[model samples]
Target chain A: MIKLAVPRGSIQKNVSEILADLSIDIPDYNRANRVYSYEFKNINDAIARSFAEKDIPIQVALGNYDLGIVTSWWADELLIKYPHLSIENLILFNDSVSKLYSTRSNDKLPLNDNLDEHIIVTEFPNITTDYLYANRTTNYRVFEAWGNPETWLNGDASIAILPEEKLTDNVKVIDSIYQGGLLLIGNKKNLKKIKESKLFKLLNEYKGLSSRSPFHFFDNKINDYVNNTKKIYSTRKQIRIAIPDGHAFRHTALALNNAGVEIKGYTDSEVIQGDLSNNVNMIINVMRPQDMPQAVSLGLYDIAITGRDWLKNFIYNYPTAPVFEMHDLKQSKYRIGAVVSKDLNVTNVNEAMEVWASQGIKKIRIASEYFGIADYFARNFIKSEYQIIPISGASEGFVPEDAEILVEGTETGATLEANNLEMKDLILESTNCIIGHKNLIDNVNPLIVDFINRFQ
Target chain B: MVDTLKKFQVIEQLFRDVLNANNFTEIRTNTVQPLNLYTSAGTLTPSMLHGTYSFLDWDGWSGERVVLRPDVTVPAAQWYLNNMEGQEAKLFYIEPVYRFIDDKNNREIWQCGTELIGISPETANEAIIKLVTELLGKLNLTTAIKVIITNKDNNLQVDNYDSLPDESIAKRLIKALGNIFDKHGFNYEFIDASQNKKFEYYTNYAFSVIANDTEILSGGRYDNLCEGLGGKKAYASGFAFNMNELIKLLSDEQ
Candidate 1:
């Protein structure tokens, strides 16, 4: 079932009417005063009433709900915080939303004044802060607001940032910071599903309902609910694990959970919410060799999983605290070997050596991903007679095309075979492995041990 | 007043004289290359990324890719695989290599080297040592040139250390050994059955020459290079001079 967040009160009625026009009957939404939640009778749709528009984006991003009808302003604001999440549908609400600005200064609001040193109070910090910063207005402070600009602006604070549509008769928009529009959004995965589902067609037909201009509004009811729940659940003992959303690390976490490990999974998005506070047990980071040493030095994760190639290239030169290989998952199949144009007459290493000796071939160029390996070959076997060309990816394609002989990683040799090349020699076969801090391995947590044991 | 040009002329003359006297030839190749060449070598691995530069070729027939030839051996071997018609050929080249490294190391290094393809092991070894020694002789450094040799058959059977997830520790250990050897003023040591370099291409003997803790020359017998390049069973051996290191050593002694 697709759960949706809809703004409560008047916006909720407007949404229900729009759904009704689309032949999606949402019953007793307005008549029933206690109806803060409603489900579609015909379609698999459930709507929870939210007093604040800001809650929709957060809910969709957190994967708590599948779909949401929210202002484009909020969607844009939330997307900046979670760039990985894509906006599903932009159903432009006919509502012309205006951004409101207020100043406590007795003098007229200075729209032209440099806002670099100004403090702007707003509950929507993500959007408002980014908008100001992106425009080169940096020195502004954002304070969370309880209800509206009036709540904060009328008090000690003079200036505030808020959605233009929320400007009421009591306050005026000194200048429209941005025009707020309506947007439909879902979780990235759910958005894919929604696009394939029949509901997408129904929503498109009723897009005209998006024409209504948004009314001045402000609500902190959702934030209050979430904060209170968080406080109550503070004792629950949440353990965080940072994993790239789609990497194998995330799968490993699931496998651990299935094996009875109670750990909370967090993506790059959720990391900024707060410190893991001794709760983060592991991080599975993937990057090239140059990044591994730095990542290890950060000391954020008790344990990390990365490639050995990274360890050798960077860590060998720079010493860091010792790390241990907990388990070798044997993934990311990497093989370092040489491949040449199929037409080359040489068939063995000996032949290649003789060619170097008698042919007056003073310099031989080998293309490979392994510079150290190439260096080793150049220094030892080829007697430093040839130049080793270091490449980062697609080493096989270099043969006869860009390079004479290519030294690269191969798994099934399908890429080489596809390119009409064959492996002349087999260098080494490798797979992804899991590693951890040396101290952590000794004081090994049961969860980590269990996770590592899976590979064993 | 002409001393500086004469010195530059001497350096150039020394390089040419050594190549001509050793029966070495020269070749010029591209400076920029594809990214996968180094990634596949198992030597540079992902960790030694400090010396290589990469860029995406958005306009070329090939899609976007990273480039900058970090070393010259691979490019020369690549040339042999494409141009050489038979299993037996002798070639030599002197070129500049670009590597990205931290500290005050030179990004561009001059490599004076030779490659012996389709040759016997004994002949290849003789050629490698002869070329290296000749190059050293041209520089006429006061320090002794020592060749430390190890056979691939004698080392541990581990393959491709660079691709390992925790390769840094092992690589560090090896580098430490190099440092230890340098500190003790040892000429050379044959690495026993337990120690093996990360590249998988060496099937025979491998060696590097060090002077004052700096690697002045390195070479080995790669009998498998021909077979790896889809050629007849052939033996290959060669050595390269760190022209930069050689120059430094020469200048330091003066």
Candidate 2:
């Protein structure tokens, strides 16, 4: 059953009207009381009403609610608060209530025509400050407002950013900027199902009704008090490191965490903690080089722990992002080498080529994670027919069992030793290396720096 | 073999004779074009764009761009807009189109199509459809020939065009009709302009011909094709045949 959490007050009425139009009847919605919970009789779903739209996101993120309809303003706030929450089904509704704009009248102040030199007042300092900075408008200052824009517009302030829809009779919009509209938030577990369900279509149709300029009419005095206290304790902490779940990555996580660093596994429990306050670092154990480019594009991991051999071969076609090597942990030492059956007479690389050439074995099948290494051998190795089969896991077991020969990366040769296969040739030796984004190298989180220092 | 060659020549001569009798002129054009030509026509999509064989020709130049043509329609429209000037033009081309497919396979498809620019919709539609019917009559096939009709506006759903975000509604309309054709046991799906043509200036009818579930011919009215290309709004209509697919279908029957 899908559990939905609806923001209380005006938004609740809008939600109820939309549900009614869809022929979805909700029971036990009290008209007088603000705190109301409703359940649909036909569908196995329940709705929880909360006054704070911001709290709706937190509840959904915590898996308390499967779905929630919150304004984009509140959704953005939640994204900042919990960056780990996967926000799927981000449908832009045409119905917009308001946008924050400058209303103060100053002949010299660039109010609407030229907002470059305007000083806008708003309680949302982070978003407003970030937006202005991104747009390259440096001459703007944010002031705290008590309630609505009407109160601030009537004041002596030269510029005040308020919701566009809520612009009063005393003020007019010189320039209108489109702020994002209402957002539908879903928990990670239900996101894929919600995307495929009819509920998604119903929500899309009702999106325009919920569209309105988001007003910032709340008291800013408390926000100012909180901001003042936050400024003093804004020191960078330990880097919060996230690792992919597995025995290998778990060992790496334990090693990093044991060295007095914050390391986490990318699972439900760790993502919910959402504490990047400590300088956070992420490590991905790449079993295959093909997975590295996609991992980097997702921007989930700050650094990936992989092999140089994989990086050199697999990253030939696509442009790779600049990476900084922190440490060569050398945990699982592997070599890109050829493996053959122990009974084979060919002992050396040159000897193996001579035997195959004399035997007229024009076509040869090789299995390996290193397709590039295999291709290199095929091109130079007496013009023999060859096909490289890429194996993901248990490549050593492929030789004399699933394949004639195998090209694989191995460390300690324990598995090869067990399989009774001998290494024919070693192309390159690889060790575990700590790599970081080049952009984040100079700005290395102090916590991450400390962790790297421990390795040294 | 010599007699067969003579017979093939006679068939070709007969086909050419019929086209001449109908006042149709055979035309051809270069199969390479600028990438923007497709994008500006509102028919360029990531899938179709990717399908076109492209290469960076930066031997002596600093910047490189894609180098092959995927569609003949866009180039044909450009030619009409440039050469015809203010007058009406009736042109046709039979050429091989290059497209990239999976497994390193490049589809070199032969297409025979016509384009009528700056003509009234009613006149253009009647002329093209009649031309197609006459062309099919020369084939002498025992299979039933079916013409599916759809309006460029109503069938294509132009209002939802912007919301689609990906392919043009006209492309989707063709794809949907293809699906319908597949379900109905038509070996080839013909996209009627009325059902799939998305360009806003297409103010008239479009159609496709199918036999044994295979689309043999397709044509449509493009009343706004000129206006979209920065030319004054002019009524346009045309149709084309998949010569290669048709040949394969006919040979397979034998």
Candidate 3:
């Protein structure tokens, strides 16, 4: 059977239409409530599954699927990092091209001269590394952010290499990396298998149609935009505070407001890297709470307000790291737990192990947004060989199929129950707290201390 | 697999015998090393750093990652700086280094290597080449080997032996290698070549001992490596024999 892997996000609709045009119809694809895996109705002995766009290349490269439809950038990202991956680009869909660029917060920090002190944050670290090496930038740390690398340009990071669309007006584009579009990639070893299958004919037809008339999905014009807007940057000695942007932003904003700390443009309803002109010594930057602890230890920030779970996760990986939760806001609390499907007929982890053993399952798959914590929980509690599948989101759908258990944080356990899953064990209770580098507490700046004391 | 391992042990024993005879102390560094040891030290190239098997351990919550030992020479220099600062030392190792190469089966390479720290480059280079030729002579593959020496300059093609510049370190090294081989009544060939991209740490020169077109041994003078790895400035040079290649060549011959 020809197993195919397809993307599940923004480009999913276009890819589904392409597949349909090639006479491969999987009705479940691109549906509102689509299942991960589906059987093709029109094609004999063929199946398809939807995965995260970034994960499509990895899954295909591992030979888990014979054929994969993914964005060429994701394919390039993987190839550039691990050049030996047995993946070949088969068909090019020139329509969905994305331009990647090297952008900076300001021209103040001369890139070449101050490279030792520069911090480059990006979603595509491999691509960023290639850019840095090509430019002879030997000294710099590239931190991989979950999303929105451009948001880090506000004093926390010196440079950001991400897509053109994500670039904010405050940042200036230094140079542009070539753009890549959607592609049909296949495993090199499985090419014979793919050619022998029914996909060979459909792919041939698609290639003929594409060559005759190049596919055009979107405008390919390069946006020659350069913003010279001067942004506020904190000196090395200035106190930088990183706060959450997504779910915890509202609560953190409320807490900061209630504590009588006025960060302009940052309110319960809205979050911003607002004008911190009033608080002359302090700079406020909004970023992923998951990224804050490490950023603080890297001296990118002096103090950060992030989840206790993230703080613990960071500490677990780097026991010697000088970042600690300085003050617990005691708000937005949740329980980090090991979750399993309700149909498993097991109440606790021990019972689940017994059930798994009875089912002859040798290795358990644990999925999590927090990989370190998942590894810790699996090692200490599971008592079985387990692999941690690091995921970004949609982790709830992993159980009963993709993963055997999910090490996830839940506020009410309502979301878990909604997905027909139940908490097997409580790993830890997490709450939003103020985490800071040890240097912040040791140096004891009176203004920083006074600001931190207000939270109490 | 058992037979191959026996051959490996035999090669290991010969290496130990020769290294010990040359006043080299056998040192084995940790199989698991901190990634910061390499990154903060700035000793490895970008390409070599990418090939390391680095991962966050169970306690790696602080975002610090560890790697399976990728290169032994750096660790050997680090060990000397930590333990024998300001002292000259001769060290050797018969260990496995983990690297992610194109060939998956060859990721775990068994290498027999030597490092001389706090010695002058000229002495260190001659001593290493002498030691390598001695070991190869012991293995009875002395006649089937070619020693290609190159410094920061000069590009010598594999087919052209006359391209190496005269009155250079390559010439001096080749002459030194020739004298060492001739004194032992051994058969060997010496050529010159360009700097290898793999030896980014090599500050002065690099040499490779090729047997049947396969580089079975390689290393060079990396004088700045000691200071680069957060240690005091000291001269260091080393070479490692690829036991996998040696075993394959021997097995094929047998």
lDDT of 2 by residue, A229-332 (tens): 21111122322233333344455556656666554342224222123223334322222233332233223245555556654443332234444456677766
Model 1 regions more than 4 Å off: A1-456, B1-12, B40-44, B58-66, B144-147, B156-200, B226-233, B251-254
Top DockQ hit: 3
TM match of model 3 to true structure: 0.80
Off by over 4 Å in 2: A1-244, A254-260, A264-277, A280-290, A297-302, A317-331, A348-362, A369-385, A436-456, B1-108, B112-206, B209-216, B221-238, B245-254
lDDT of 1 by residue, A364-417 (tens): 777665555555545555653676655434343346634556766677878777
Superior candidate under lDDT, 1 versus 3: 3
DockQ by candidate, in order = 0.01, 0.02, 0.22
Query: Which run of 10 residues does model 2 chain A get worst, by summed lDDT?
Result: A225-234
lDDT by residue for model 3 (A191-286), tens: 988877887568667752142122221321112221232224433555778878887777776677788876666654645553342466777778
| Alpha-carbon shift of residue A38 in model 2 (angstroms) | 58
Q: Kindly list the interface RMSD, in angstroms, of each predicted candidate in the order they appear.
A: 20.2, 17.1, 4.6
Native contacts recovered by model 1: 0.00
